[model samples]
Target: MRLADVVLPDSAVCSAAVDVAETYASPALLNHSFRSYTWAAAYGTAQGLAFDPELLFVAALLHDIGLVAEFDSHTVPFEVAGGSVAWVFAAGAGWSRDRRRRVSEVVVRHMGTEVDPAQDPEGFLLARATGVDITGRNVDDFPAGFRAEVLQRYPRLGLVEEFVRCFEDQAKRKPDSSAAAAIGNDLAARMARNPLERPE
Candidate 1:
């Protein structure tokens, strides 16, 4: 299916989420957020994975807010901070307490190595999509043409270097953070080698 076939949510919460993300996120980060949701939604559609599109859209868009100066936390990991931001955003959007919690959980779990699809389809889809975007892992799972369409809509810009630098800064401050783990595993080199950076 083409990118247009992947129906996206356009609710009030989704609109507000775009506003907040645009206000805080850099151009590249904002594009990355958009691409994350696009990838997740498209992948989910391809796999027939049941998910909440509105919640996934909000969580995916705001998942990296903690990396921005306005929301960055000095103590907690970026994902934790992002999760908190999602919680508050959801509350403001008039979501139920449980709905707010689920969005927060999806945001926090986006960084997971593997989120169980049966347990949390949104989380699982986000993790898979981010993995594809960031490290090019499972890049071959989706149709090549669909992937190209998504990238055309939301180009990577300078996401590779910028994201690596953000993670490095986080690692410097929080050695116990997941950023540290990613760095310790040589994330920079991995990012450098991401296939998306290469020509088709």
Candidate 2:
């Protein structure tokens, strides 16, 4: 499906969102980001959550959309730059108060270690999902909150198989760079622990 089709609540604002995300994200990194988000939505679905895939997907796609404006004329790190852009985009887009707040929270806190799973389930889930997709292990080395449900819903072996396939697909499509190399390494490690030979 088209990138636009995957992200929703379409508007001029959303179009700007894409442009914003593209500013600091290398083509490859952007693909990785999308893949990570897609995996999260899939995992959430497997766990029986009625998540808005399109909304979550778009949110994931544009989580770093703020980087555009921040890095345009500054030398700050992309994370900091992206956070500033996020605030601007949220305001310019006329995002609902809650969405603006959540988007801002996601951008600013994405790289931190201060996450509180009990207090912010969605944030926790997003962080965990990003970790798994990027590093093949949940941050803090914790098990997924919905691990049992995911396994029960899809069977242990099936879940492993699905994740393997998703990882492989992401690896193949990932843009080349240091970040992609890291993701590749993580995927390899995950695969070694749970091998799933692809179909011929």
Candidate 3:
């Protein structure tokens, strides 16, 4: 499904974020990123921490919004690129410092699995919500601290299982793997270039 289909409408908080994020991110990249984040949110919901699906989803969508303002080289680090976007979006949204900090942390640690439990709880939660095992394989490889935090903070949104199952079914109908790999590589390279950090 498309971003409009997956994103919730009730919360203006996240909807606004999506609007800003999509305005800057390439259409293809936005679509792919949204799908990935949606899948993760579904997984998290299924695992029992029922976070505000819209909140998490919006955060994921705009995680890289900084790229738009920081568009310099093509190899900008993800954390730096994403940080720029978070700073701008948070400022525009008038979010508190804590909220901005949380968004920044999520953007930086979303890809890597080596999250520090205490220092990066939001990052840890995003990882859990996205279903990436810290060990990079078995779901059981997730750290106890991360898992416990998710359970405590997010509870269960009740729609995650359905979302995950639907995503699984959709993945089965995809085309050749090579094309997917190529697309992923291209996107990664583009993201690395710091697209979100461009001056507005």
- Best-fitting candidate, scored by TM-score: 1
lDDT of 2 at 18: 60
- Residues 61-103 of candidate 2 have per-residue lDDT tens digits of 6654433333432333334445555656677777677766666
TM-score of 3: 0.53
Please give the lDDT score for candidate 2: 0.49
- Encode model 3's per-residue lDDT on 141-160: one tens digit a residue: 33444444433332333223
Indicate the residue-level lDDT of 188 in model 3: 34
* TM-score of candidate 1 on Cα atoms, chains taken together: 0.97
**lDDT of each prediction vs. the true structure?**
0.90, 0.49, 0.48
Candidate 1 lDDT, 41-137, residue by residue in tens:
9888888889999999999999999999989999999999999999999999999999999999999999878799999999998988888888888
Clashes of 1: 0
Ten-residue stretch with the least lDDT total in model 1: 191-200
Residue 130 of model 3 has an lDDT of 41
lDDT score for residue 183 of model 2: 49
lDDT of 1 at 37: 91
Comparison by lDDT, 1 against 2, better one:
1
Q: List residue ranges in candidate 2 displaced over 4 A.
A: 1-15, 50-55, 64-80, 114-121, 138-200
